[model samples]
Target: MTASTANDQRFREFKMPDVGEGLTEAEILKWYVQPGDTVTDGQVVCEVETAKAAVELPIPYDGVVHELNFGEGVTVDVGTVIISVDTDPGAGPVAPAAAPAAEAPAAPAAPEEDEEPQGRQAVLVGYGAAPSSTKRRPRRQQPGVPAQPAALQAELNGHAAPAAAPAPAAPVAAPAPAPASVASAPAAGRPLAKPPVRKLAKDLGIDLATVAPTGPEGIITREDVYAAAAPAPAPAVAVPAAVAPAPVPAVVSADRERRVPVKGVRKATAQAMVASAFTAPHVTEFITVDVTRTMKLVQELKQDPDMAGLRVNPLLLVAKAFLIAIRRHPDVNAAWDEANQEIVYKDYINLGIAAATPRGLIVPNIKDAGTKTLPQLATELAELVSTAREGKTSPAAMSGGTVTITNVGVFGVDTGTPILVCRRVLLRHPW
Candidate 1:
């Protein structure tokens, strides 16, 4: 190979690293940089979806992009080179025959064929070193259709490319005022925006027609919708005039067989539930009690100056009651270790509270909750609920729970068979 070709071979290839713990593979959802685009180190090149969550992969070298090994929607194994970058962009391509074979040993090879130099170990930090072997799944296509490029195939398959790189939301723009002649006129055309953006605008009570478009090709953007909702002066002044009220949309009947993909937190919850149901021999008991005095105390707590601005709801009392009950019957918090043929008793109470979020149900617990005073428990409980609702609960927050509490009364649910979290005792409260 010629010296120029040898220089080009110095291009760095970035592999699909393991983004999550024990993740074996990920589906390329979208590509932010196509071949020939200039890329910088630490720039997010693409987004991938694993079993647990969606994560973005960043390029690690500064260079001109050479090629993308696979197209969008392709499920790539960990350690497979996904993109190549030519470090020397100014160098021109040389004829392969013109180069001396002995001098051009590093000329080039397809990413799949490329191997690490002997004696030098290359590691991608948190991802470890690329695997010695790599494999790509065969492309799926119509019987007669010819093979297409990665991007084109991705479009045809409709595999999460659009959501890969969510367009940066623009400020919500208000709908521009209409001319006097068309003040009461129906919209001349449909507003331009992605379905998600439109849904957000609808939820925020922002009229699309009134929102100004700042996106490319006069598209309405999320930022535009948010800007309209802002108290600041809007770029477009929406005309407030009497117009026919929009007709209510009829609700469609539910499908008999509604299929929901089990993944992420939902999948984890399902697996845990199944394991707990079969592995643990549960003996449940129920007691009805008058909570009239409890409700009076909640009211009294709200009136107390010290409790002002803090959450003092029925759940708080329920949590405290469980803690007191556990304190009296410490043996209930023990776990049965079948493998060891022993019952493991706990010294501390890491009380977990079940919370429902938009994504799925999660149980984030308060650490050493049994040691905390009532006020401290209330504070921790409030924070845990808030974090769970926002989907920001960390794995650490959800681990090491000695027991769990699920408040069915919050949903007007009288009671529920609370599943154990990791073979631990779980309590259900109705009031």
Candidate 2:
């Protein structure tokens, strides 16, 4: 075969796999391997942030990196082609693939018009099931109204709109257009503001239609909503000569404020916390305990050869005591099944240790923690903390916990009412 033909046959596309259970998308945090780099089977090529955690994805086969389909920080849907590789680069000089007329991220080939769409495609990792479809549902337009293009709709909705068509290669050399006069009001229809901004305006009892949009493409921003909500300045009265005008305070510029978009582990944590707060009835009981003997025992364990190199901290002792209490009272280590209207008691304990990391708060559990010895627990705890701190904790490590313990004393806080995880009891330890 010719070099071009051989290269075409050797190219393999790698799709984004579902790293977390039932997760539909993930943001590309970092790419470890760039185009033209070599890769081996099971070699980590990139790191992605899912709703559950930050996970490293490994390539499934050995190859020379052909292309990177998406850039970092882009949130791509599962099953989209993320990278391509030339498995047999030694065959000959690889021919550059022709770019399509439409400029967009690489995606899986669509089925023929006559061919029926298949179910979920096989994923890159472990041959798991990928998403059945990545196409979005069509938006409903009002009667007698013409349908707007996707990019225009996105712009109207106060989102960063994508280009409607590919731009010219030398577009930057083109002459700039004159700036248009700002509109006093939005065009006829719903006011253009993001969902969060709309919520804020509603909460502040302000009408969005009355708020002048200072954002690009006539989109309303939070500042616009706030300005609209501000009470009208009192009509100034004719002041007497003796009455001195009040000094004006220094005005802080809005540019100083920073807004971070909620996503990934932090977003998931917030949703889970809100759901937990409303769904579960929480009751906290505080008690004083003398831990002088416990501290001495911890020190003694640190000196023991069996516990050498193992973490022997007060938290370990607290976890041991909590496990023992659960052993005595098994009813406390159970979850309520609201659907079945029953209390499901667990036969084994998966003890979760809540650790706060740079990404967010994650509760990774040690499987069958109740059955492990003190030394084993210490070893696992140390490894867990290390893994979590490095942002390498897998989704499996954070799931299926029967009970959880969070050490509030680590932050020097006396106590806190921690929300329950997975509807299981959470014990907060404080020094």
Candidate 3:
């Protein structure tokens, strides 16, 4: 129920919501707003990916963005504040202390009567936006030194030392080594740098311990890391005629290979596939059916007046046949409830269509395939496939599927035994 800053009632924080039911975390895919951007209520500020699908999160209140807590591709837990907004930008900028005060655990608590109602606010995703109860642990403070503002710290680390903080006068004879030692050994212990700067140094294959620090209080900056990573110029001096140049060593370069961190939809898909493969019994049965008649029917349906704007293909007829088969054999459309130690039979089928997308393989389903006409089915299928391909499928669209149909022929693959989606029956159609 605690706000970011009780004194600044204009500032409001938006936490990462559980976009999917029981989803604990989501990776930020993209940010649509930056600090100082004016945003209206119901404006989409960012996109995130959970285990099931990609979701766009809209800001619930109108305001100017004050700050973004995490960068893209960073996984954040539910109930964590992701963005802060200044609802009353006309009131002028708040003091720098407001930012750090949000993180300070020892700040004076507001009276319980003054607190805003902690009821859930309406949002596009999840049940609603629940107020974030998560708090930062208090940081230990030195006796006399005051806590530094984040902006001031960033400014100090980004520029040269101020003229007011001149170095103490040393003997003229020792001036040369003083500059060298100060540049190379800025700190007596481990190298000092922000998390982002350290990550940059690591990605560039630069050793922070060897790179010179240029920021205040021995902090290493991004520029220093790049400087260390840059290749040194070759010496211009020519070798003597009597001396042979030393043979160059055969050193391997890091550029020969690339490493990509697995996260987001791809990461979730991998985890799910692994779990389904090892935990469930995989039965791969192949039946080579004569699809010549079905293909002819697809061509005939393409010219039908009712199906003019609808997608008519072999997959459509195959999916319709599969639904009919499920209707006859309802026992095939059921899931084992492990917790309840029972088989949960479903009367209505949420038919999942597995589509290979740039993000990964996503199986978004039609809500009730059993109750739709052929044209209705085709329309929904086209919309679902297009949405999945565009990486815009919602989590709800991908959940509660009783059966799935995957068309491997689209990828030029004859056939494949795809792992079951959530232990449901899967049918793979070959070319």
Query: On lDDT, who's better, 1 or 3?
Result: 3
Considering only N, C-alpha and C atoms within 3 Å, which residue pairs clash in candidate 3? none
Q: Write the per-residue lDDT of candidate 1 for residues 1-431, one digit (tens) a residue.
A: 66555855767889988776666777787899999999998999998766444567789898889989999978889999999998778867633545445664685544444555455566666465554453335665544444465566567555534434545655655556544342233346777789999999999999999988888767889999999988876588665566756779877668445777666667777887899889887767788889899999999999888787888988888888888888898998887787898889998889988888876788778988888877888889989988777655655676678888887776776766777776675555554
Go through the candidates in order and give each one's C-alpha lDDT. Answer: 0.77, 0.85, 0.81
In terms of lDDT, the best-performing candidate is 2
> How many angstroms is residue 403 displaced in model 1 relative to the true structure, after the best TM-score fit?
0.5
lDDT (0-100) at residue 350 of candidate 2? 94
- Give per-model TM-scores: 0.49, 0.62, 0.63
Q: What is the overall TM-score of model 2 with all chains considered together?
A: 0.62
Report the lDDT tens digits of candidate 2 across residue range 57-156.
Answer: 9999898999999999999999999999989888777666656598776776787654435555544664653334434455765444545766887786
Q: What is the lDDT of residue 22 in candidate 2?
A: 84
Which portions of model 3 show Cα errors greater than 4 Å? 1-8, 93-253, 426-431
Count of clashes, each model:
20, 0, 0
